[model samples]
Target: MKTIVQTPDAPAPIGPYSQAVKSGSTLYVSGQIAIDPASGELINDSIENETRQVMKNLGAILSEAGMNFSHVVKCSIFVTDMNNFAKVNAVYGEFFTSNPPARETVEVSALPKFVNVEISCIAIS
Candidate 1:
């Protein structure tokens, strides 16, 4: 069976989608931006800060599904500018310390709320 996941700690879906979906032992997390759930404010002060917020949002969703960074198997990173890749990677690395999940980062033309970064992940519980 498939289950939808959600949490108040993470930003609510701006459109018609759940924060994540779980099927069997695998959970698919939706791409997360820098929207702060509590205040619904965009956190885009700097590349690092934006990345941090995006990670935080992703963390919240994982927590809701009773999972964490260590459980993540893969990640997809999206950014409007490749110039900020290093900055984003630094913050992203902090979350996954040992045997980090496989990931790929790509440059896109734009993102919702004009944020610089967004991240999605897949985790196995």
Candidate 2:
């Protein structure tokens, strides 16, 4: 069976989608931006800070589903500029220590809120 996951620790969905959905052993997280859950506002002005916030948001969702970064099997990262890839990767690496998930990073024409980075993940439980 499939289930939807929601948590106040992370930003609420901006549209019709749920924060995440679970099917059997895997959980599919929706794309997360840098919006803070408490204030419902963007968290940082710089790409590094914004990327950190995005990671934190994803962490919160993963925790809510009883999964951690180690359980993540894959990730998809979208960035406004490829130039910021290294900085984003640094912050992202802080979460996944070993056996990190397979990932793809791409430069997008634009992102919601024009944020520098956004990330979505898939985790197994």
Candidate 3:
């Protein structure tokens, strides 16, 4: 059966969608931006900070599903500017020290809330 997952630690969905969905051992996490759930504020002061917040938001959703970075199999990262790739990668790397998940970073014209970065992942429990 499929199950929806939500958590207060992560920013609530801006639209009508759950933070994640679980089907069997796999958890599908939705794209996360830099919105801080505690204060509901956007953390876009810097690209690194924004990426950190996005990763934090993703982490919260994974935790809610009883999973972590190690369990992640793949991830999708979207950025408005390819120039910010290095900065974003640095912070994102902090989450996975070894055996990192397969991922692709794409440059786009825009993202929700016009943030510089957004990330989503798939994990197994």
Candidate 4:
């Protein structure tokens, strides 16, 4: 059976979807934008800040599932601009210093809220 994960520390889904879902020992986190959970404001002032918020959002979901970055096995990063890739990577790298999860970063046409970056991950406990 699968269990739905939710946490007040993460921004509420703008649509109809769970924050994350867990089956067996694996958890699949949904894509996270830079919306601050406390204020529902998009953190778009800079790529660094936006990516940081995205990671925090992802972290909140992982935490809710009793996991952390170390538990992450894979990650998908989406960005509207390739120019921001390095900036985003810098912030994302801060979370996974060693034995980082396998990941792919792609440039997309756009994202929800028109935010520059979005991230999702798969983690195992």
Candidate 5:
């Protein structure tokens, strides 16, 4: 059966969606923005800071599902501008030491709250 995952450490979904969903040994996390859970506001203005917050948010969801960045098998990143790609990747790289998960980064017209970056992930236990 499918199981829903959530964590108070992560920002609550602004709409109708669970923080993550687990099926067997795999967990699928929803896209995470830079919104801080406690303050309910974006963490910072710079793409680097925002990307760090986004990674933190994803980490919370992964932790809640009994996983971590090492367990992540794939990631999908969305950015408002490709120019921020290197900065975002720098922050994202901090989480995975080696053999980082398969990933795709794409520039999009917009994102929730018009945030500069957003990321979602899938991990296996």
Candidate 6:
């Protein structure tokens, strides 16, 4: 069985989906953009800031699901511009100081809200 995981600390889903879902010991977090959960506004001021917001959003969902970054086993990062990969990775690195999860960063033509970055993760509790 799966349990829907959500938190007011994270952005609400824009479509018909939950922020994250937990099944057994694994939690699957949905892709998170730079939407500010408190204001419901996009935070695209800078690539670093944008990525930070995305990570925060992911963190909130994981926390709600009773997990943390250390529990994450995999992650996927999507960026509109490959040039911003370094910036995004720097902010992401701050979250996982050691034993970082396996991740793939992909550059795409565009992303939801046209934001430069989005991130999602899978965690094992």
Global local distance difference test of model 4: 0.95
Worst 10 residues of 6 by lDDT: 59-68
lDDT tens readout by residue for model 1, 58-91 = 9999999999999999999999999898999999
User: Which model, 1 or 2, shows the larger TM-score?
Assistant: 1
What candidate 1 gets wrong by more than 4 Å, as runs, is: none
- The global Cα lDDT (0 to 1) of model 3 is 0.96
What TM-scores do the predictions have?
0.98, 0.97, 0.98, 0.98, 0.98, 0.98
The lDDT, on a scale of 0 to 1, for candidate 2 is: 0.94
Q: How far is candidate 5 from the true structure (C-alpha RMSD, Å)?
A: 0.7
State in Å the error of residue 71, model 5: 0.4
lDDT of each: 0.95, 0.94, 0.96, 0.95, 0.94, 0.93
Off by over 4 Å in 5: none
Best-to-worst order by lDDT is 3, 4, 1, 2, 5, 6
| Model 5 Cα lDDT, one tens digit per residue, 8-110 | 9999999999999999999999999999999999986788889999999999999988888999999999999999888999999999889999999999999
lDDT of 5 at 57: 95
Q: Give me the runs in candidate 4 sitting further than 4 Å from their true place.
A: none
Candidate 1 C-alpha error for residue 115, in Å: 0.8
Winner of 3 and 6 under lDDT: 3
Q: What is the lDDT of residue 90 in candidate 2?
A: 94
Worst 10 residues of 3 by lDDT: 59-68
